[model samples]
Target: MSPANPFTRRKDRIDELAATAASPSGGIAEAGAVDEKPGVSLIASAWSRLKRSPVFLLGAGITLVFVVLALVSPLIAPHDPAAGLLLDQVRPQSNPVPGPQDGFPLGADSRGRDLLSRLLVGSQQTLIVGVFATITGLAGGLSLGILAGAFGGWVDALVMRVVDVMLSIPSLLLAFSIAAVAARPSQVTVIIAVAAVQVPVFARLLRGSMLAQRSSDHVVAARALGVTERAIVFRHMLPNSLAPVIVQSTLVLAVSIIDAAALSFLGLGNPNDRQPEWGQMLGRAQTYIYDYPHLAIYPALCIIVVALGFTLMGESLREALDPKSRR
Candidate 1:
């Protein structure tokens, strides 16, 4: 190799010396240290964390599958859920079983309706009940919570007292009571019953979250700046306060599913056999449970899986939101 230029050789030596001099004093380096990054919005950060989590991935997959199933059920399901294609092939199985017939994949229910079709169609019903009920609860809770949080004193006391009264009783019992009093049991009755049980929970959660944020620096700064009360509450407080509510809403969906199913199981849900709902299917299967446990198993499995999916996603979100948990 040609001899290095004198100036270039000197510069390289100097650079090496500088790096050596600047090295950390101790043998141990700050191995775990990371540069502090600019802060991200709560939602963006949560989403980033969620994307990295296996639990979130699994829950999202399951949720997506169910959502897809619900949307295209009519197009994909082989047979009408209300009408069974093969009654002769329908027989009680000690173990969960499918049919020999090409058209009937999951076999028929106690009424000879295709079990697969029912399960597929049933997803739509369960999703509707779980989602709409949560929405109902969220609405009631947001209204009450905002009033209590934004305007304290008697308004807070009054809303909280009512919430406490409802909270004292078991949620399921309260739902049953509501269903009994609200005319006859039907689809509408089931939704309202489930929604009623969830209202207090949402209301209490929002109130506490809002209260904690009420005295926050940002809120105080907004007040000092003479921002309108309406703007402060709606824009600043509500947005920040809603993260917990959104997470709670996911969890509430799981509860709503169970409650709707429980009501149907108790014969307080839609009584029409023509309508294929998981809980109602479970209710019907109760009579033949001993002879054919499969009848109950299929519907119960679907319910459990769906609820588990929502629960995992919600818990992942909760952890994402919590700084302590994130660490």
Candidate 2:
């Protein structure tokens, strides 16, 4: 029999090549489809875990409520926080007042400013200061901590020594000292003072977390694979180290808010009397504690509620984030 024609042989070879390509392409698509399942499962598992944590839920709810209150204060508050109506000021709680004009619900301050309105407005200032200060502290401290932990020797010694010195001083005294030197206490000054005091705590916590994470098997494996030092530290170690940082940050927020209030109480916060900051109000109310107890009580209560909310959130976050607790 005659041998197959060369042209026919070439056609057959091309067909085989096309078939091989099509098969592998289909296999790749199938593999991708299979991989999507695990990705979706991971997200669902995380959601389920979060849903099961009652503490987390409670903390989230409280935080959301305060955030809403702050946002809607202008619309919901009955009277202007800074506006004083002297004729209607400090009406006694026992007075048979029935309307907003009589200041029935939230008693008027000595200055006749609505206590509820001031509290609502003050919440905005408090939340803003606390959040900004916490962010500043987190950014500064995390960078320093990661640098010290990832690169040992002189860098670590220098960073830790600075932290040690800061930690040795009482935070309140340090904040007061800085505030005193400031031209006048304002929101920016309060934020700076609070962040300055918080930086050391965050730096120490983050350093410990980073040190532990750096020694883990995954990090060591990444190092052995010739990954860049920056990549390993930032992309690999940073994510793992965040668990402790997140827990610590919530606690720091509580401390920062208290410190800010203390600063205001000490007459070292925003000098603008019209701003109606909780701490400043407390400072002003102290003089009238006997005659107008509501003045002191309202501002003091605001501080307590905000501080308690932050503390609760911190504690709940700590418990929820703990691996041991999960087990």
Best by lDDT: 1
Per-residue lDDT of model 1, residues 1-327, tens digit only? 999999999999888766765678522234534688998897798889889999989998898998999989978988888885665555556323334357776677756678888889889999999999999999998999999998989999999999999999999999999999966788899889899888989999899988998899999999999999999999888888887899899999999999999999999998787878999999888877876688899999999999999999889989999787785
Per-model TM-score versus the true fold: 0.85, 0.79
Which portions of model 2 miss their true places by more than 4 Å?
1-54, 87-104, 325-327
Off by over 4 Å in 1: 1-39, 88-100
Residue range with the least summed lDDT across 10 consecutive positions in model 1:
91-100
lDDT of 2 by residue, 172-199 (tens): 9998888888987788999999899988
C-alpha lDDT of all candidate models, in order: 0.87, 0.80
- Model 1 residue 92 CA deviation (Å) reads 11
Clashes of each: 0, 0
